[model samples]
Target: MTNNSTCNPLLLGNQLCFPLYASARKIVAAYNPFLKEIGLTYPQYVTMMVLWEEKKITMHDLGKRLYLDSGTLTPVLKKLENMGYVTRSRKPEDERVVIVEITPEGQALREKAEKVPYAMGCLINRKGNLFTPEEVETLKKQLYRLIHALE
Candidate 1:
């Protein structure tokens, strides 16, 4: 067979996913110092955000919202439960259903977390605010479109 790797469309640099993957990792890593101070990993912080908004939600629903599977979420929930940030239990009406609720401690964390986004914003802006607000919105919209299309 003739060699064609030189002009292959599947070359790493030609893929759209590489930049998205790298940027996502960089963005999450940039939040580490702030998240570390609050005693949460990125995944836990996001899970907590959903709990903060909903107060209480079923495990399945929470997983759906977080785009996580129960296998992955179970451990995060356990750690949060152990940390006193959330309480997880079986639903009285449906034993098979697990419900996660934010405790007073988790609510307290919300107050401290209020500054995290602003801190991350400052970090990104310090790196030169590469995208204008409108551009950011456009990028988000486009990404959402791609996500939905993939889904």
Candidate 2:
């Protein structure tokens, strides 16, 4: 008689998505305090990033920039409107189209946020991480390029 045992344990290093997902969670959590001070959630912060780049855009354009659909952008935009950070209104010439414009408050908030990416960079660098600001921006460009290419 013989007995055999196997340990198919999934260790941290063995799981690819685990680290990526974990890192994202921790990074978002780290931004919580800062974002709270600025009246934003993770998604809203990303939304602000897009609006900061484009002064005014159609809802469709906003969705494209955020890689989200109306279902997602609609609610977030609504929240921003409630916060007086943005204005969502029907286009004057096209009743079917909604235009989103950043408000003065939103613009000011974005100015305040200019340092957020840098601060986040510092946090990531503290643990001997390989990502610096340049690497991070490059990576962002590459990922957005990939996203656009896929779409």
Candidate 3:
């Protein structure tokens, strides 16, 4: 009945998920100062990113794109709406469908956010970098593959 490290499935070090979770937290923390200056939390920033690109999209599609459920996404949308950055309204033809669109203010914020990726890139890929730009791209592709597979 002796415990063996190789056979210990419950060990934290044996879980692939731990590093992924921790790395996501660290990356989000790194984005905090820039996001703070923009007056958005990370979730809001990501939501706005999609809205900026799509200009308008349904709530269902936004949730699928962001990997968020309505329970989690609703509040984020509400806050963005309250900030006058976005507007959410029911579709006239389909009451059950809610559409989200970026407002003029939200579009203006995109100018401020334009610098965030560059700043984060410098932080992550400065001298003695943890990952090269190529490595980052490769990793991102791999992660997306994994996400698609999971879905």
Candidate 4:
């Protein structure tokens, strides 16, 4: 029987998972400077993504769209509200349901946020930016497939 344990020491760089995870983290960290300038974190940016697509949506719907739960979103929404970017309230039609709506301030912030993609584009340009567009597309597709498959 092959003694797999006798294989070469687990060189982190040689392991796809380690390097891949570190690379992802490093890239996300690279975005920190820019994101900080805009007062948003990675998770916050994702939340803005769905909110940008839908002017107003229920917390439940937002959670579903963002793959987040109330525990994660509640504070994020509160922060946005405190920043005057969004408004959260119980739905008049369904008091049981909470709704979130972006304000003019939020829309204006969206306009400001329009530059983030450009900023991120420049950072991803390392290695001639080989991993930027291509990998993003492929990874999104693969992750989507995995998410659906696992579901």
**Residues 3-110, model 4: lDDT tens digits:** 664464675534656765787799789888888988998888777778888989999999988778899999999998898888999988889999999888887878
The alpha-carbon deviation from the true structure for residue 128 of candidate 2, after best TM-score superposition, in angstroms, is 3.7
What TM-score number comes out for model 1?
0.91
Winning model by lDDT: 3
Relative to the true structure, how large is the alpha-carbon lDDT of every model?
0.93, 0.85, 0.95, 0.83
How many residue pairs collide in each prediction?
0, 0, 0, 1
Which portions of model 1 miss their true places by more than 4 Å? 1-7
Error of 4 at 43 (Å): 1.9
User: Which of 2 and 3 is the better model by TM-score?
Assistant: 3
| Model 3 lDDT at residue 80 | 99
- Give me the displacement of residue 28 in model 1, in angstroms: 1.3
Best by TM-score: 3
The sequence of per-residue lDDT tens digits that candidate 2 reaches over residues 50-119 is 8888989999988887789999889999999999999999988989999999999999998788878878
Runs off by more than 4 Å, candidate 2: 1-16, 132-138, 145-151
**True-vs-predicted CA distance for residue 130, candidate 1, Å:** 2.0
Q: Write the candidate numbers in order of decreasing lDDT.
A: 3, 1, 2, 4
